[model samples]
Target chain A: MTLLSALDYASVAVFALTGALVASRAQLDIVGFIFVACLTALGGGTLRDAILNRDMVFWVADPVMLAVAGSAAVTVFFSAHLLESRYRALLWLDACALAVAVPAGVGVAMGMGSAWPIVIVMGMITGCMGGLMRDVVCNEVPLVLKQGELYVTAAFAGAVAAVVAATFGLETGIALLICAAVTVTLRAGSLALGWRLPVYRARPPRNGPRN
Target chain B: MTLLSALDYASVAVFALTGALVASRAQLDIVGFIFVACLTALGGGTLRDAILNRDMVFWVADPVMLAVAGSAAVTVFFSAHLLESRYRALLWLDACALAVAVPAGVGVAMGMGSAWPIVIVMGMITGCMGGLMRDVVCNEVPLVLKQGELYVTAAFAGAVAAVVAATFGLETGIALLICAAVTVTLRAGSLALGWRLPVYRARPPRNGPRN
Candidate 1:
């Protein structure tokens, strides 16, 4: 199998694990776990393909991806109770998934010869949107949208790195490697070293009831 | 200028109003209002077009739909406080939008010569997904999934009505009209007359911590 496909599978598995962990936290049934896992694993890529108007969505083209996600969900459904800290596991697994997914998105856009902006946006979307959707659907504040997190910033920087590397005529595989490395490094830094961004601190409305 | 286009515009506008009202309740700024409005208005159609592999997303092709959503957001930004019960307004407006949107989805699927099941699913997705996204994003239990509510059932029944009408040699326009009428009547009955479907009542797990 191609390295790219391997990375895609890895990301799907990890993201599905995180999603099923979340479903466990929500106390969902096995069917709910599978549904959430598949949704979280496939949501970002699906949206990217849709926006790019790909001939077929990735999972639709290869049902094995769906199987991978479902397997992850089933595994987590039985094993999640043993985890002492599912949230921490979710965060770290999500970072790893994001690292791989950003490169996947960049590669697809680059393959399609999309403009730099579109390439960058697609990478961020692919890396971030699945988690965002999972959080939103599960009624949690999205990690990507959390104040002071470097999650989106990391994805953006990684995508930009890929674009810049490609602009300089770097090999496609090397550029994607650089993208993944940068993404994971920054995400890891945020998780382990407390890296942060400035957060919006809204002032009280001058003349309205507070929401 | 066609009746279909008119209905599409009406749905977008009303859905945008509901989204903006949600934003108001969420205490978001003007930009947030516009973002939520556009997302809520265009999200379902975007997913529909993507799944159907349309040449372009509806708002991307028309652009005017985005403008309509944005305008609704701006208007609601200044005026939402005037409503005594924003939630009530949201429910009614959402029902109206669902009525229009289901027919739009059915029309698109029928135009593509999709099978009956696809037609029913596409109609339900287009009518129900936007509101589901909105509520999920805002951290509310999704109205579509609310216990005993007829929201999804109404969309499903409406789509089936359209398919059955068309199969019986009805004109396309008349079939969609029937779709809209059925959707609105069922949704309105649920709202006004407390019509309902049986809800899942989960028994306590034989052995697990209460979620």
Candidate 2:
């Protein structure tokens, strides 16, 4: 497999595991576990392809991805109860998947000759949107939008790193590696070191309301 | 404007209204209202086009749809508090949007000469997915998936009505009209007459656990 495809598969497997863990927490049936796993594994890339108007979505072009996701769900369904802390496992696995997926998005958008803004947005979307959809569908607040989390910020920084690296005439492979490294570092820092962004604090109006 | 386009616009407006009302209930700011409204208005058609690999997503091809959703959001943001029962208004508006959207989906799929099953699924996706996304994003149980409601069932029956009408050599317009009529009737009945489907009832397993 091409390096990009390998990264895609890795991310899909990791994300599916996280999704199935979430399904377990929700007390869903086996079918629900499989559905959520596939959705989480494929949702981000499907959205990025749709926005870019790719001729076919990634999973549609390669049904093996579905098999990968389903296998992950089945494995998790029977095994999740053994984990003492599924939530912790989900966070770490999701960070790893983000590291892989950000580069995949950057590579695909760059290959498509997308503009820099679109490339950055696609990278973040690929890295974060699957988890967002998973949380929403399962009725949890999205980790991407939770107060003080560095999830989206990390994805953004990673995508910008790729763009900057490419602008400096780096090879595509080298740029993507840098992207993945930057993503994982920031995400790991947030998880392990409590790095965070300042959240909005509501305040009274600075001035009286206009008539 | 074509009949299909008109129906599409109508659905977008009504769906946006429901989305904005939901945003009010969520206590989000004006920007949040606009975001949710646009998401609810455009989400379903976007999903349909993406699945079909359409050359351009509907809103991307015609940017005016965004303006329509935005207008609806702004209007509701300013007036939602005046409603005696925002939830009731949301339900009725959502039902109206569903009626128009089902026909739009059937028309687009039929125009592409899709097979009957795809047409039916596309119709349901178009009619129901926007509201599902709206509810999910706003952290509410999805109305589409709620037990006993005729939401998805109504969309299915409507799409089947369209397919059946077309199989009898009816014109596209007539077929879509039948689709809309059936969808609205079922949805309205569910809303006003307490019509419902049988929901699953959990029962203790008769057979003992197997090794």
TM-score of the second chain, each candidate in turn, equals 0.95, 0.96
Instruction: State which candidate has the highest DockQ.
Output: 1
TM-score to true structure, per model: 0.61, 0.62
**TM-score (C-alpha) between model 2 and the true structure:** 0.62
Report RMSD (Å) for each prediction in the order shown: 7.3, 7.5
Question: For candidate 2, what is the recovered fraction of reference interface contacts?
Answer: 0.08
lDDT of 2 by residue, B1-211 (tens): 9888998999899999999888777666564566678779988998999889788778766768877998999898777666667778889999999999999988899989999999999999999999998887778889898789899999999999999999999999999999999999999999999999999876667887533
Interface RMSD for candidate 1 relative to the native interface: 5.9
**Residue B34 in candidate 1, Cα distance off native in Å:** 4.2
- Runs with alpha carbons beyond 4 Å of true place in candidate 2: A1-46, A55-128, A137-139, A143-211, B202-211
How well does candidate 2 score on lDDT at residue B102? 90
Per-residue lDDT tens digits for candidate 1, residues A1-211, read 9767887888789889989988998999999999999999999998888888888889999999999999999999999889899999999999999999999988888888877867876787799889888998898777775546678778988999999999999998999999999999999998999987543233354564433
Expressed as tens digits, the lDDT of each residue in A1-211 for candidate 2 is 9888988999899999989999999999999999999999999998888888988899999999999999999999999989989999999999998999999998899998877866776798798889888998897777765556678778888999999999999998999999999999998998999987544222333443311
Q: Point out where model 1 deviates above 4 Å.
A: A1-43, A55-124, A134-139, A144-211, B29-35, B60-64, B197-211
